[model samples]
Target: MVDLRRARTTPTDRPSDASGKGTRDYRHSWIVRGHWRNQYYRSRGDHRPIWIADHLAGPGDKPLIGGERVNVLRR
Candidate 1:
């Protein structure tokens, strides 16, 4: 069995310059969804399933396009 969920969602930013300052360019950015994976471990002759969370992949600086959705986690 595999279970996946969104861990967190955040806006992406441009790469920082030498001065450690980055521009807020959302035009070229896109949203990347998160997911989970399973890990098997052998302990005492038992296979344990470990759920690994994944981080959002992509430059989320750009605003969401039409019909695009993102799962935001509230603190």
Candidate 2:
């Protein structure tokens, strides 16, 4: 889950402005991995092809299903 609460500038995370008006939002939900070569993917037991990336996927992360493989189809 992304931390949407107020942030404090310290030695670690830096603020975007001098007054610290904006902080880095480290929270991530999901994103498509790799190129959008295909439109849908599905693993075993899935009723339908997953049109979107995995919910657990994040930035710089690859979309994976059951820690195995993903079947993609060209749109």
Candidate 3:
């Protein structure tokens, strides 16, 4: 038996402006947290499960609602 424990990961901080006021743009936008996934690939005429690295999604902008945050987890 294998103990498939998921690693805990958090979204990296958004980039800040020159004034150091944090990442707050006029346009409403938000950053999607990065996460891991299991993908299947063909290897030697067989399918193998591969672990994909985490990747950030969406533009780095403030959320539409105030104090909104997004968290993603492996499925």
Cα lDDT of model 1 by residue, 1-75, tens digit: 445998896747557778887764445434344544455555665555555553443466545444556567665
Q: Comparing candidate 1 with candidate 2, which one achieves the higher lDDT?
A: 1
Q: List the residue pairs that clash in candidate 3.
A: none
Of 2 and 3, the candidate ahead on lDDT is 3
Which stretches of model 3 miss by more than 4 angstroms? 1-43, 59-75
Q: All candidates' TM-scores?
A: 0.22, 0.16, 0.25
7: Cα error in model 2, Å:
18
Clashes of each: 3, 1, 0
Which whole-number lDDT from 0 to 100 does residue 69 have in model 1? Answer: 63
CA displacement after TM-score superposition, residue 61 of candidate 3 (Å):
7.0
Prediction 3 global C-alpha lDDT: 0.55
Top TM-score model: 3
Task: For each candidate in the order shown, give its overall lDDT on alpha carbons.
Answer: 0.54, 0.49, 0.55
Candidate 3 per-residue lDDT over residues 1-75, each given as its tens digit:
345888888737767789976674455554344555555554766555665554444455544434655465656
lDDT of 1 at 4: 97
